[model samples]
Target: MSQRYHVVDRPDSRAPLDPRKLAQVLAQDGQLLLPMLDLIEHAEAAVDDLIDVMGRATIEAVLLMSAAGVAGPKQQGKRADRDVVYHGSQAGRVALKERQLRVTKPRLRKRAPQSGEPGEVEVPAYEAMRKDGRLADRMLEILIAGVSTRRYEHVLPEMAETVGVSKSEVSREAIEAGERLLKGLAERDLSGPDILAVWIDGIQLGPYHVICAVGVDADSHKHVLGLREGATENSAVATALLEDLVRRGLDPERRRLFIIDGAKALRAAIDRVFGADQPVQRCRNHKLRNVTGHLPKDQHEQAKATLRAAFKLDAKEGMAKLEQYASWLEHQWPDAAGSLREGLEEMFTINRLGLPSLLRRCLGTTNLIDNGHSAARDRMRRVRNWQSGSMALRWTAAAFDAASKGFRRIIGYEHIWMLKAALEEPAKDRSLVQQAVAG
Candidate 1:
């Protein structure tokens, strides 16, 4: 037996001894992992708190000592006890962090996480969680939450105790803290997404560009990449947006469907960025309005019904119903039937396969993004009209970040898979279609 390394059969300093002689520890204690992360986190928060306290305390001490008779040269010469206390506290913090760093040992991490040999290696599970890139996400949530959400109450009226930067020094500190988090998210190497679809479109925020990327995540739930400010909804920005999505951990190969409303810039951008073959679908409900606009008031309801039939979760039956409705419209309402005859059918382009909940929700007209947009608009509506484009965009983005905190992205995995595939091309699957009975 080597004296340098033992099986830990005898209890060690990390875990208690003499409790169970038969079982050696399977891994280093995971409980320590959280504490380790917290240790560094608290060290930082402590530094911030100290700065605030020292600033206020030093100001108070100076005023008090001056009132008591210390003035001019004497006041300058008399060093307040507050300075000594502040330095002492800071020194303690330095000592505390040094102790924590000893145990964190982030540098000890393996060069190769997997050796490819199948034997099990003892690893602390909690450490493994952050080791596999989850640390970035966890840290992102923490940092973004701080500046981007509740913490920003200092910047505006609605939310927090810290209202208005109140002072220039506080403003600088808050801004610096926010930039640190945003810079990390913006610069990190985002890879390995296995993306199944990409939702690209320039959303309206008063008059500014609010291009966004929405799509399914690893667990197959939809995630909103973010709202880009000032970036044109044109081909250049959309292309850059695609590349950004890739950096934000989206994989292009896994994504096949591109859903958007028919904005000329958005369409051109997607094509210029993603190329012509990228499977695209116009929002179904949005198209129906155009379709019905051509109809007589009396026929609008009938036309809507006909259009809705095509969106049935069943492909074959919907197609047959669509044909019957088209025939009725073309023959009976010739004056209003031309647009439907020419392009309304294309709206059904992705619905012919079994509807994926994502496609189904998207195809029917109102995209889930539309809902978020609506929420933003409701807030902006209070302003009557925004004073400037930046004002509108900022309010909208902040509103979304605040409101979407509770928005649970529906992945509709099974639906998204079929919807993505069906969007690829469905003429081949046309023959596999049978009349689907309504549930």
Candidate 2:
């Protein structure tokens, strides 16, 4: 074996308990015996306590080594040059998820700083945990995951008891965290994202409805644009969201596509804010749902197939076929026919623009934003009652932030060029074409 390095079977340290002694004690007659569950619990507690003890010992060992100038043993001549001296130990506490250790924290005094050296001596471990905010962040993550504050005592027994975790404190922290997220969402600069399209939809929480906009950039990345609380998808609410986007750097002159559920107010808002000629695609899926919802169960599949097939054809033919279907259903199901006829032309905007099938499939509906809403609902599923719009907005902002983390590029991203070309067509050229068609 080399003198420089050696390995021992076990380090010279005192074991907390001897396994053989424990077994002998357990086997003794007329002794109070622990049930298996209690024994296992006690064993786990012992292990945790031992781990804390080991950590404290390691910290003390490092302090000692620093004081000696070398990691372990100092050479005879080199020991005299040591600059760090261990002062004394003071009571201190550090938190870990499993436990908080009451440590005899070692103090160190260092020689005066030489040129270019730091003057202060600091505890590396203590400073590290404090700087990282891991302890606070871990607690916040637990609460955000819908863990009850009372149960935190069980989850983080030592830290919770030591710091006195309270329900009010947890609620305050969560609200503060949520407000920070909401502020970031509202104030974040949208100029950099290169948004190519925006999808808007409403989600209901309790009796409140929040309209959310999710934007897709040229690179196919999605961003949670913003949100507004509204009772219905009305012009005022829709205009506010669009104007907010414009204020935050969305270019109304850029001719980006608006993928939305077919609401007259939303369409009117787009025409007023963006332009009358702006490219808009009403969600085909929403239209399908509305039409089929009004039809008899026996007629649903047939209507759905007819509508879906018609949507695949060229704009004029598709509209003609749908009109024929509506006429056929006019007598037995006038309401269903009317639902199908409403916004019928807007549903085939993608086809009219002659976008590629792949890109059409991605942008033809507001499903992308709807998917994000689904994720937001999953995050907020634990929330029972909403107190106000502000409260709902804060929670929704936090939920959106969480949901947006997993956004991948839109499907059929490669064919995005086809849609881009359609959008880039000149307004003057489109106007003249429409005029000629009308003539």
Candidate 3:
């Protein structure tokens, strides 16, 4: 008997090779030189051919192993009589990235029918194909790319027509994808990243609220750290989000800056989770809006300009100037005065630390988190009704993950080293103060 062999094309086959195409392939740098049209035609054929070859090989290997008594009898193992015999192959199908291919799997049965039980022999090849998730992944990718479920038949009539009507299959696959993403976000180790600052904020979707934390690393790159579902931005919800990050290896003791809107719950959460002395920079923009809302419409611009001018002064001078303005306003508008005095020291945190204008511009506001919320909202704008908190969390996680792709270093990022130095100053001073108190 002669052994059959299948031949493949040679890399430089001179069999009617187009010289222009060959020249282009040679001149190009590292890249796939296969023609697009040819790949589409041959890829499916290759997959089918491979599956059929593997199917036959699997059966042949099983027969050989059975005859050799590999699974029949062994020392200290259950012994089987020579009653089991080979049976005809059964038709099956395996999913591949290109398409589904038909396969024939051989079976074995007892020579004497004691019972209707069939002998089970493992097919490693078929199992490998079954475990290959590229087909499902590609399907989900297409769906995310705006290919509607109804159009799957028209999009890939040869490969995905069955999938068009299998809405449940698509849903199951999407759920798996979403769970994987959520798990990755939640369980990722954060100790490896040199996170220099955290921007925290809450976003509302229908009746659910999600508090999200975005971290800025030492290199000025941004990361969506984690999120928690909450009914409102309360201390408990904020604390849980921060604690989860800590459990995932975020060092709460580290003197990283915390930039947040004027939420007392977030401030308290930071103090409780990180430390009472942790450096917190209240978003100056939010403060400005709150302060100006108390003044008359005609006085708003002047008040904003006054605060802006005060921010340009040094920390001591800025605080004194703001305090003077508060005193002046106390005569007529006490509410506005109280607003300026509340968290007044935090308003000039960037100034107190003496960071560069560019770096301060990035650290002085919760704009980064706000921008992430805006991007996330844009991604989920089509969602009309968020049925449950879990649903909102899933969709928000997906949206934020999508938004994270567009994150670049904050503006004036080159001077980030200055911000890092400033963040360290407070911790150093506190240690010194503690030592003095001990003395």
For each candidate, what is the lDDT? 0.46, 0.70, 0.70
Candidate 2 positional error at 286, Å: 1.1
In candidate 2 the C-alpha lDDT for residue 275 amounts to: 91
TM-score of each: 0.52, 0.73, 0.67
TM-score of model 1 relative to the true fold? Answer: 0.52
Runs with alpha carbons beyond 4 Å of true place in candidate 3: 1-131, 134-168, 295-299, 327-334, 426-439
Write down the lDDT that model 1 would get.
Answer: 0.46
Candidate 1 lDDT over 200-319, as tens digits, reads 555565556677555654446655565555444365666676667665665554426666765556667666555665656677666677667777788778777767756763545665
Clashes of each: 4, 0, 0
Query: After superposing candidate 2, which stretches have Cα over 4 Å from the reference?
Result: 1-14, 17-128, 131-165, 432-439
Which candidate tops TM-score?
A: 2
Question: What are the clashing pairs of model 3?
Answer: none
Q: Rank the candidates by lDDT, best first.
A: 3, 2, 1
Off by over 4 Å in 1: 1-190, 226-240, 246-249, 313-346, 356-359, 362-366, 384-388, 411-439
